[model samples]
Target: MSSLTPGVSRLSQPPTTAALTARSSTPVAERAAQVRFRRAISLMAMTLVAPGTAQLVAGNRRVGLVAFRTYLGILALGAVMVVAVALDHGLALGLAVNTTLLFWLNLALIGAAIGWAALFFDAWRIGQPLSYSMGHRRVAVGLNGVLALGVAGVLLFSAHIVSVQRDFILATFGDGAASDATHGRYNVLLAGGDSGAGRWGLRTDSLTVASIDEQTGKTVLIGLPRNMANFPFAEGSIMAEQFPDGFDCDDCMLNGVSTWAQDNPTLFEGSDHPGMDATVMAVEGITGLEINYWAMVNLEGFKELVDAVGGVTLDVKDDIPIGLPGDEVTGTIEAGTRKLDGFETLWYARARYGSDDYSRMARQKCVMNAMLQQVSPASAVKNFQGIAKATSDMVETSIPASEVDTFLDLGMKAKSQQVATVSLVPPLINTAEPDIALVHRTIRAAIDKSEGKQPAQTTKKAEAGSKAKADTGTDAPPTSTTSTTGGSVGSMKDGYAANESEDLATAC
Candidate 1:
């Protein structure tokens, strides 16, 4: 038997070959049917989810639910196809179209929010029940018409909502937004102070420095501890200096200066220093960056801004217990991602309990990052109205109205880039006692380093000049400026850099 060739044995086993062929064919047929069934199921599921005939069965009136559903179906299908093409081929054209459609849809929804308030209130619907008593139903019909007209009027007048919102967007990221090269390059100081709501006094409780670099397209955020003292006032003066002839009264702490300027408008004329300008200049002096502009917003504005954006989602970087008014009202936020409404976001920014101002600044920056993420195109589509309203009410900036277009262009261009953050930690700069003189020195040195300017000794000159001016109200000559490297200032050491900015380098 072994001598017989293998081919001769196969020739004798044709039946086996037939059986194997049949078995293979059967499985192929079965698999084909299975694939068909899966395709059918997928189609059915899509139909069910779509706004279509099913909507008519759901009993929606006024506008035909079926038609509305059909429109949504078209929108959804288009979005799906667009996304698929974009992903599979990285088609810029397809993405552009898809984004445009989404933008329009978002705009429509925003418009609808203002226009459809009456629908929620039932004012646009007929007041009378649908019945056979037709002749007298005219009253209800008339009433409905009047209500609809009123609602339309509201929508017309409410147009400012979106405009204000666009303005706000312009302020933060800059106008045109598409070309935001300066997105994270410059530093914008955010302050949380008490203002409005019957109490008009303003004092910055929290200070945050946001740095955005246009060349690097990175954002660096640093939060300073409010308690860290030794802020430079004049030369020997540990407290704020008296007002210069043209400057506002410098009697209060840096935080209180804005409020003082607001009250003494005459002295601070043409100088909004008591408000955002002064704060910005001080921050510029400390950081050594020429601040482009500043925005000042208080608690009331903060709440309003957050509320307008509906709410923002945030990642809990650490466990923080927030105390509310009733009892020891406390909330422990674990380290994770969570959705935060306006009130909670506000609380997160303003929270100081069991945390230092440094911690608060970190939280504030975190919240801001989260906010930028939330307002991304996809999320913006879902919450345009809220975002628009919040932006309109909460933002105040010095960016010119004419330059909004340029800012917007910049913003849109840099939308997808990574955001960078910068902070001056210990070894570079650290907390110290509230000695105005020491602070001035450190600040001057930092500024000099940033500007590539000469580092001279000015601490003693500043002190002497400050004392002489305090006594005689006379200004110091450029030659009288104290040396910062090794100078005599009462008993303090001389390490502060010389004041070089002649325009603003005057000691108190």
Candidate 2:
């Protein structure tokens, strides 16, 4: 009862409250100064750890705005990645795009970080011995040491990023797959598949040959129509041999064979054509060029990649407003130079109905040209992080990362070079429908001529008098050449002689 009656002790007097009030009554300017100093220290610490924080430290309003934008952007992108990688969508179209944006943004952040450190050095320079007394030299040296250490740390991390990326490319695509010795002049056959994203299963939806010659500094893009007929597999090779029926004279269309490869995974490895080795060989046989690298991408992945770049622009040849089975519908647009969003562009590329396959091929090439042109240094700098993110999420290729820089260098060098486009239309290269057999072998020979490769040398007669007899209409003797099959030329499981005989007749 006594404790309850005694409410306030001397120690618990209202003096503590008065003291707090007095402290709170300090001048607003002084309080503000203290708060600002505390904030500066906090920001510096945070900036050192988070790349985006460079904006706050560099005193670069433009970079600061970019960093702040990226901070929020990354959070949103992370959510999209989660949806694409974890949810049922599993790197769905939307998520893949978000991831790409994140990549480009992240790259920009790295550049910003380096800039911030440099800014700090500049600030320190303002008070250096060069401008002041010897006494201030020690302070300047100490500050320089600190700045150097910070810069070294940032560079170390940037190196790690590059190393990780290189390792990833090598593991996924095989080392030096895109090297000049292996993939001369940068003519890469790229095929986009249908699988959504990140999944192992995929098929070629958009097929093209991307060629670049650094010596001449030109990049040429050639699209291949999916329905082009009379595509041959290597003699008794993997793609044709996987059919288990020996080389099928009936299976001439490449797309059907690809579909067949998809349905029978045991015969193939993944959901793609097992005969791509053969396909490349066939292209070599036709184009007469030594094709060294091949890349396959999925349509979903391509769409995601395009969107990740905030969409691409292209000059339209004509108004395209049509819908097709198994294709996403892009709405109508006026013909002229125009920007294409992801789905719209994809649909436009796939809009080949009523148009010949050659026309479709041309459209695809147009899209690629637009994309490459759009990849300006400014665009790359602006959307660096987003590009990295999308590349991780939306693509799977056989080209390794170490080779990426080499390829990019070659690309940059060739950005201004003139390019040649070739298409094998009706009379040039004929493939019969249903049976899908080639009627002429010279066409394949001509393709080789274009690619700077010579045709198989013909045996000379005993005497000049043996001057080649008048050519007959019948097929010529077997010639050693590249095969569309998975094995090397002349290694067919079936009797090599018989297979070669058939190859000579088709000449694909």
Q: Pick the candidate with the highest TM-score.
A: 2
TM-score against native, each model: 0.48, 0.52
Per-residue lDDT over 131-217 for candidate 2, one digit per residue giving the tens place of the 0 to 100 score = 433444455566555764677577556654554443334334544434564243656777666664343433455566665654544
Predict model 2's lDDT versus the native.
Answer: 0.50
Clashes of each: 46, 34
TM-score of 1: 0.48
Minimum summed lDDT over a 10-residue window in model 1 is located at 484-493
Cα lDDT for residue 287, candidate 2: 44
Off by over 4 Å in 2: 1-186, 196-202, 240-252, 262-275, 281-288, 325-330, 433-508
Best by lDDT: 2
Instruction: Tell how far residue 271 is off in model 2, in angstroms.
Output: 12
The CA lDDT of each predicted structure is 0.47, 0.50
Write one digit per residue (lDDT tens) for candidate 1, span 408-459: 4445433544443323322223544333344446444433434345756454
